[model samples]
Target: MDSKRYIQLLKKFDGLDADTEGENTRSSVSYAILSNSETNQLQKCLGARLFEQGFQPKLIKTEFNNFATDSLDTEGELFQSDLDFVFFVLSPMGLKETIPSELNERSQFASSFLSELEMFVKNFSNKGVKVFLANIPETSERVFGNMSRIYPASFLYQIQAINAGINNLVAKSQGLYLVDLASKANYYGLSEWHDNGLWLQGKYPCHPRFFPTICDEVSAIFSSLVGKIQKCLVLDLDNTLWGGVAGDDGIDGVKIGDGIVGEAHVQFQKYVLDLKNRGVVLTIASKNYEDVAIDIIENHPRMILRKNDFAVIKANWEDKASNIQEIAAELNIGLDSLVFLDDNPFERGIVRDHLPQVCVPELPEDPTEFVDFLTQLNLFETTQFSDEDLSRSEFYYSESERKSLQKNAVDLKNYLSMLNMEACVKPIDEKSLPRSVQLSQRSNQFNLRTQRIDEMTCEKYIKEPDKFCFTVDLTDKYGALGIISCVFMSLKKDHLYIDEFIMSCRVLKRTVESLIFNEILNIAKENKAKFVVGEYIRTKKNKLVENLYQDYGFENTERSDEGSLWRIEVSGFSDLDTSIKVKRS
Candidate 1:
């Protein structure tokens, strides 16, 4: 968001004085901030952000300047409460120290700083809490001036050493992420970010003036961890993607290249294409004739994206708000998962009115400002990314092909047989850890129990010999959908328990579920187990799978306000028949 909007929102947050009663009691998520500095305003701003996202913000904080005692003591209130995540804010000002004498002394300082960080993070992570940390911001003392690059006793050089070690430590530690506060400080300029007078007087994390920006940054990281990130980009034509109207100026007359004004649009196109490369599905929802807009996409020399690059295209004279709805439905994604970019104020305002869940950034009139404005929102942040993410756009193309074939087929069974599907099931090894954890966070609609596991807990499952953690990748005549489903199970005596089972919505009616169910029965029978158990945890979006166990002939043994439980004897179980071929790894 822009600076002006940040101030406006903070003002709105300041007016919530009467609604501040359950600030300490745990809600949906209990978040604790253990900072070495004063965190009164930081807690307020982060709570405001979470409240805006439809989540109950249970803010937990430590006493001022006593973060160490709260973090290190396991029996303290910080750990005693049901805390889900934590942020460890550190700064050099909090830890008083003397400057090193020479360049060789920098390594010693870095080692000590990293050791302290490791201790704090490991303390929380050992108890199954996710940790978010920030490196100390860099500031120059001006002792060596520009010669700090080679100077023997430069604070900047020492800061660089400490930051380097922070990266290595976070990488080695599972469920730990290093959020760079220095980068944000550099963006807003050091003068606005650092206030020496306020630091000495009240011990604020940064200048109180810049609290809005930093708190927004930290809250966005938590948002992505809960699988609330946008997945698609919906674009508009005319002044939004080019300099002039396509109908009024014609394709040859439209200014997209060979001119000074056209270069700005070209730069914006490159930024959008880069988002596509990183697995953001690109789609167009413009108010134009289909043939004319596609001609430009097909023949324009400066266009960075082509017609095939998009997963769906809705170019017609219909209202942009309805077009956005159609795009979401066609892709089988949530309306909140789309980021719509339109240059016209009228179109943006209309969509915002109709779909409050959709993210509509206020694009400046100047095309040059488009990239920077969108980059600052951080709309597509993610907790985990994998090689499957890089090729996810192809899955949409495969979906399109399947839709066309289904339209011509005689019936659902014929469509399934025509595709000739195949499913490859494998145990979750170290190589599949990243994608498996990502699916755990992303899938909801088809999840059996919707258990979100982190990499560290999953690694423990891999090493425990008795637990079964596996993944399934599907392919057909059309194309491949990599790692689309997963099953995590364990055994207790004679019964095998299915803790979590999740599948992508794209494979909803493809009989992939039947193949997986057959595989689970096989695993239980091979282990000489007497019964197979399954669970159904009720959530807002998981109603699709509430009757899944019943359809498979598992008897419902238990039901409650929480969820339902089912069990089937192995002697009575029969293999579920499916058209898809199966292979094991």
Candidate 2:
């Protein structure tokens, strides 16, 4: 969107503030900004952006030019309130007062600056809050003309060192995230991003006009928390993957690799291929005969994406809306997880009207601009990524095969035994922490408490004698489902409490839950606990597990508006039935 229209939309959205307007339609998130510059405008932009994206975000205000003091003050809003995310927005302009003029002194200054910031980051992370610290904007002050690139003490070189230090800090620290302001500034162009006049007048961090870009970046990080992350990218065939319709142009006539238009299509396909490589499930929804499109994708020499790359292919004359719905059902994913890209406006409109939850980007008329458009949209944002992401498409494809087997199986136990399932249970450590925390963020329907445990807290649990954080990795005849379940527990005086239990939806009906629950009982027994307590906090998406504790022979001891609480005697509890064998690591 253009800046003018964008500003108007934000104003309208900001006016719809649920905090004051009492409109409770969207999910609400609490966030605060700690910046060394004026951040009222940044808060406004972020709040509006969240509201636009189906969230009613509450802005926690902070003192002006007091980021350092606020970071140290435990009584400040940064520490006092519960927040989904806390952003430490930074700007080079705000650091002008403290920066050293002498080239020799910059190294010392950068080290001191990072040391202080890292200490504060640790403090906040200890509070169990997710921290987002923005890397300072990259700048070329032209201190030594063309030689600035080589000079060790030049401003450009020093900024690079500082950003690198920030990168290293966030990399090692659990629950801390870098906002990548340098990359955003470079993308928007340094000159166009900052407003000198506004900075001088009110200490604005960059231009208020581009604040939405930063807000969007922040929203992407929290998207997984609310289960808003997109996992699939669905593509159209004619004019999208190639220059002409595959049905009418035939395999040889379709322009794919030899001309200007064909090269543009190839570049777009390359981008889509990159998404697939990063674990975005690719699917085809083309309004054409199956053989014609399949022939072009398989036989055409210039086709970058082969038939195997797509998890699902619906090449028929059916309306794209129906095709996309079938694709989601076949993959066992929500419609909101799908992103549709088609060159034809009519198809885009049809999908939007019928499947409003699916994200349909307006593909640019020119094929060359396709990549840039999607890049700016930031459709796929994730909090954590693991090697398991690379196999996501294959994982879903295997589900279809499993369904075929399920149709012919005699019973549940027989089906599970036929698949020959095995599970490996292990404690959360440095190696398993990434996927452990990721499952906490990603699993919604199967999450009992919906508790998102950050890495730092998980590490603390590993060290604490009374706390236990462990995960389960499942494998069957189909393939390995890496780290499909996780359980967080703490030993009380007389009982073991299950803090969080999350599992992948793909493994729901496969007796994996029974295996994990059995593990929980074993842990309680090992700890010599008298009782095992399980709690289920109600959520809109977690109705699948509303009766989780009840189903597992946990007697309900307490019930309230929030959820139900159950406990069972560890010694009296019998093992839940499961076909899978266990392996401990």
Candidate 3:
């Protein structure tokens, strides 16, 4: 989007009714910004961009330098604001005022600064607010001239040391995220980013022209943190994966390897393949004959992605929008998780108009710029990568086989039993911690309570006696569906509260949910608890599990629009029968 049009869209956000607009009442995200420089313009620009992206942003700007002390002081405004994310924007110029200017004292000053910043981050994170800490960018003006570059004890070295320290701190702290402001400034050109006039008039560090770019970066980070990451990339075969239409130009004529245009498509394919390797399901939603597309995918030597790469292939004459919806249903993923890429503007428009949730990026006029355009969008930001991610495509492929087997079975129970399913339930340990955290972060549709936590928090729960965290790994005759489910519970005085009970949608309708419920009851029994309490937190995607508690024989203790609370007496609970074999470790 152009800058002027982007600003105009932001202007429209000022009068929008925060309650009636967007998909849900919870569309609004409360964020607090603490900066050493002026941030009113930044807040307005960021809020506008966030609002445009289906989020009603309510921003609370704190006084400059308040981040250093506000988090430490219990009575400060930072503690009072109900915020989902906290942004601490820093600049070398702002730090210069507080840190000692003397070269000999700078090392001590840098250490003290990092210590205080680390404490602030820890305090805010302990309170459950996600922190976005900005790396201090090198200022345009240099006080030490060339001396700053060569000397390790110079002011520049101190800033570099502090930024490196911040990176190390964020690596260990799950709740803290680093925003690469220096890279952003470099990308926009230092001259274009720094406005002396604006800095002199108001303490604003960057020019107003660059706010849209800044907003885009920040919004991408926030989007990934909130679990809005894209899961599937639906691609068109003709003029998308290759340089020409397969039906008209034949597989040999399609440009995908040697020349300039061919290499461009090949690069695009390589990027898509990289995404596939990291858990993003690849699918074909093209308007072509299925036989021709499948032949090319299987036989083409230049193709980086093979026939087994795709989870769903809809290469028929069907409309793009209908094909995408069918693909989502077949794959058991949400429409919002699909990202459509096509060279034809008409096809893209049809999908965009019919299915608004799917992220359909506007293809550049030139095919060579496709990779660069997609890279700039940063649509696939992720918090963590695990072993399960590397094998996700295979898991989905196995699911496709399971669906075929289901169609051939005599009955639902017969189908499940024929698969020879066995579930191994075990406590969360070092090996399962990463996948367990991923499940909590990504599982939405079948999740009850929808509680998301980081690896640190998951580890903390595992060590706490009152808390119970375990994962279920399922393997059938077809393949091993690793860590397909997770259960988290808190044992209070006489009650066991189920904080999260989530299962993969692939294993739904196989009585796996009953197995998990029975396991929770058994844990409650072992803990000598009187009641097992469960909650159903309603979300845009979790409607599939709305009646989960009632289905499991838990009586509704309380009900509201937000969610419902259910409880079952330990003595009254009975184990639900399932054909699948169970193993505990």
RMSD of each: 2.7, 2.4, 2.7
Q: List, residue by residue over 525-585, the lDDT tens digit for candidate 3.
A: 9999999999999987899999989988999999999899999999988899887799999
TM-score sort, best first = 1, 2, 3
Candidate 1 local lDDT, 261-297, one digit each (tens): 6888888888888888899988899988899999998
Task: Show the colliding residue pairs in model 3.
Answer: none
Candidate number with greatest lDDT? 2
Q: Could you give me the TM-score of model 1 versus the true structure?
A: 0.94
Residue pair clashes in candidate 1: none
Residues 478-552, candidate 2, lDDT per residue (tens digit)? 898788888999999999999999988888788888888888999999999999999999876788888888888
Candidate 2 collision pairs: none
Where does model 2 exceed 4 Å of error?
18-27, 410-412
Q: Each candidate's TM vs. the true structure? A: 0.94, 0.93, 0.92
